[model samples]
Target: MTRSAAIVLLLLSGCTLQRPVPSEPDATPMRIVSMNPCVDTILMEIADSKQIAAISHYSQDPRASSVPLKWAMQYPVVSGAAEDVIAASPDLVIAGPHVSIQTIAALKRLGIPLMQVSVPETVDESKKQISDIAARIGHRQTGANLNAKIDTAIAAAQSGAPPVSALIWQGSGLVPGKGTLADELMTRTGFRNLSSMLGLKKWDILPIEGLLSQPPAVLLAGQANMGAGNADSNRMLSHPVLRNIGARIKIAHYPSSLLHCGGPIIIKSVARLAEIRRLMEAKP
Candidate 1:
């Protein structure tokens, strides 16, 4: 072959051998399954609807789910069953640190990629969790924006009003004490956690006599209404004595979902507490 002809032929062959440009990088998870409700909520916020294979069954329950039930119902749910997860054929399976060991072992045995996210105990930890998950799913910018919103809400809540004495009272007089997310949130939102004032530690139940002796400025009920027509369950919160005492104190409702998990709900919870603070300050 002539030199020029040979050169041209070689160039053509090189072109033929060149690989076509790949389509956009698969940033989204092809098939995602979440075994934890908290992970399900995070995935819903960051992942595309089509990318989700299945979500935790707890997300389908209105009382326990952080995400809206209507939105959760749009996706299929799994009960953390290894067979169900394997059958879903998910490329990435997200779970909490506390998921069943058998399920984790089964997924590992099958060589499925499993990501375990732990429950964040503070606002900073919660933000880190969001960033970590978002990066894992190739949504770093989304995670940054979410963290920004959380920070703004926190600042607004802290600056809303002066601190008031507040007790996070739940069913059976249970109180979240120092070192808990609720305690930190309450302090940040301009409230002195009565749990600490009353010498209650983490996860302690307050005695009725002790609480009556030292009343708080605000009684933040974990449930909006604990009146389920059950006398035993309602005795502490609904008793006429407690109701009479509540008349002199600020009573507010704090949802159970906001307190259980840390994520986008922190924004709403902080904002709500700020509003309550403003209202309390406005009161004569």
Candidate 2:
């Protein structure tokens, strides 16, 4: 072939090589790590089976998560340490606001994209937090649906109830006060939380004697303290002073995950309390 023709062919080959090759878009996180139980539940609810890499150990507890134990068993559980998280090398990581600040800082330094979730102290705040997490994970629709469910449950719970007072017992004689999720749940479930009237904030350790003397008509106990064979519940139930309260007393169990950390599960917690309230009202 002529030299000119050969040069033209070479140029044609070079041009063809320079043309861009069409490629598929990147996948949306095939591996995810959740450092908090709240985030773990949210992720598991929406993430594809192949996408979840690991979750916090707390997700294994049925009381703490909606995920079944069998499902939780399929994934590795991280204890919220930098080493464990780094080893997972997940495409996404979720951490709670209460998670160790130092661990978060370390993960950030390592250039991991960490999503921070806040613990809601009120029902309104819980809704906002759930929405934020859902939006972050591209599940805004799911969040909206869940929010509607929560609203309906709360409304039903509040219907047809007289002015009833309630106290929430966390543990070790601690009661949650005003501006807290516990208070909000109690209020939404058709009862007034006496803690707010007394102007308490956060969880306060109350004297057992004082509580017995002026106990509310209904008492809500934390799930941790109400679990079967719980010594704390046994002691409280067996207390002589507690048994003598004139007002009707009922033990309502609050999910520790919802009350302790605050998340989407709070809606379920409200529903549970509402059921308890219905049962209490039925007693003649």
Candidate 3:
């Protein structure tokens, strides 16, 4: 029999001796397939390497993944398809809030266990997510340890001098405003979020004309580098008018991989912010 067929047979036979039963206290998933990039990082960090059957295809892309490419490449990539999950025969499938309803429904129909992680808006929410996922995957201790590291990094990043005004300008002009993890990170890292400074609410677009009229001292542009190629074509970010405005601003490049997700990425973002703040201080 093929490997997938054997796995399906094992599942059908109710092989309690090999896999952890749902009611077990150590109900760890013997095989895990992550459908979300954020979940991919969490699983990679808290679960044993052998337990991971596959991670999101985005995890293998450096531009979108929080995990190192070398490490992420060690696992197979899933495209959020139910068939892929079935072929992998993972004991647990983890997805993000944005996953399609069709995918979720398909998984449920196949009697697969699913963990949907909500988008965290605050630091406390992020911590809770880490703890929740860890416990679900039977890695409570690992989760606690990772939280300690994030807390320490946040403390260190919080230290230093007064905050500076900065704008986190993602591609096409979308900006994370108040009540978002990005907003919280900015406050912790000694940089005031210009979106909040301008009284912009959550999910508000940062107007290019407004930005050019009253430029921030620092611009945290994600995915705006020249190598981004035609990806920035016709986008206000790469428009010639903004170039003049960008020249007067200290534009610091923040990785998009570190922007959206909550996991070990938080610690990395905090550290990167510290370096950026230091550079701004050193300027004439």
Candidate 4:
């Protein structure tokens, strides 16, 4: 039997001891496949358990997943290949913005429908995306419930504390600037992004030299606890100049996981930001 046929046979046979979600079905279920990690998160929130045929393989990796790996592992995974998608037998496939032209054409040729979602730069955009994706999945009320959760998070994260100047430092000298989701999160958590003073754009590099001069009251390092193997990033973090600023800047962990993608994740991201902001407030 061919590889695809063999896999189909495996599904057809009674060997489902290892796979979490089996691939056999009659023709009545709504099997939705998510090819993006962020999309995987949103789908988990709005779609019924039986509606999810497969999720992105990325969600299976704790290092890259936006959702909890323990939760995501309960579903099947596909690595964004047309063949893999076909094996899942999806009625609709939702993908991230970076889908290749070839993959799109292949899906089209195979008669599988595709929906692509882009990264939202702000919280409002993220809310709209959640509702829209939920609507498309035929669970409009569930989508509204998710959006209500975001609204609650936003309200709870509202801070009366003064806007302390801060910079969200990610690995390799990259920083989030105005109009990005990180920036909005910081704003809501009582942080005023210092990247604006350095004339940075939406997403730009803020070198160590710039850090020495334009220090903020708080430095939220995205890779502070991780990415130790990145030699160049390590050198930047361990720079002699950065060592001397402890008395002036409050360096704290702002995990790289929160840097990209927003869905149900916005709640956690905003909460962390507020926690750090409150820490800063408690100090002189």
**Residue 85, candidate 3: C-alpha displacement in angstroms:** 1.2
Tens digit per residue, CA lDDT, model 3, 1-284: 85445445555675532333232334688788898888877777788888888899988876566788899989988886555766777778888877767667756655678888898888889889999989988899999999899999999887478888888887767788988999899988888887866767796777787677667888887645556543222255667776766568887877666788888888988898888998988988
Residue 114 accuracy (lDDT) in model 2:
67
TM-score of 4: 0.84
User: At residue 15, what lDDT does model 3 achieve?
Assistant: 52
In order of lDDT, best first, we have 4, 3, 1, 2
Full-model lDDT for every candidate: 0.76, 0.67, 0.78, 0.78
Of 1 and 4, the candidate ranking higher by lDDT: 4
Pairs clashing in candidate 3?
A: none
Better of 1 and 3 by TM-score: 3
Off by over 4 Å in 1: 1-28, 223-235
Q: Against the correct fold, how does model 1 do in TM-score?
A: 0.83
Model 3, position 107, has a per-residue lDDT of: 64
Q: Which stretches of candidate 2 lie over 4 Å from their true place?
A: 1-27, 61-67, 222-234, 244-248, 253-258
As a whole number from 0 to 100, the lDDT of residue 209 in candidate 4 is: 84
After TM-score superposition, what is the CA distance of residue 69 in candidate 4 from its true location, in Å? 1.1
Displacement of the residue 31 alpha carbon in candidate 3, Å: 0.4
Q: In model 1, where is the ten-residue run with the lowest total lDDT?
A: 16-25
Model 4 spans > 4 angstroms off: 1-29, 223-235
RMSD of each: 13.7, 13.2, 5.5, 6.0
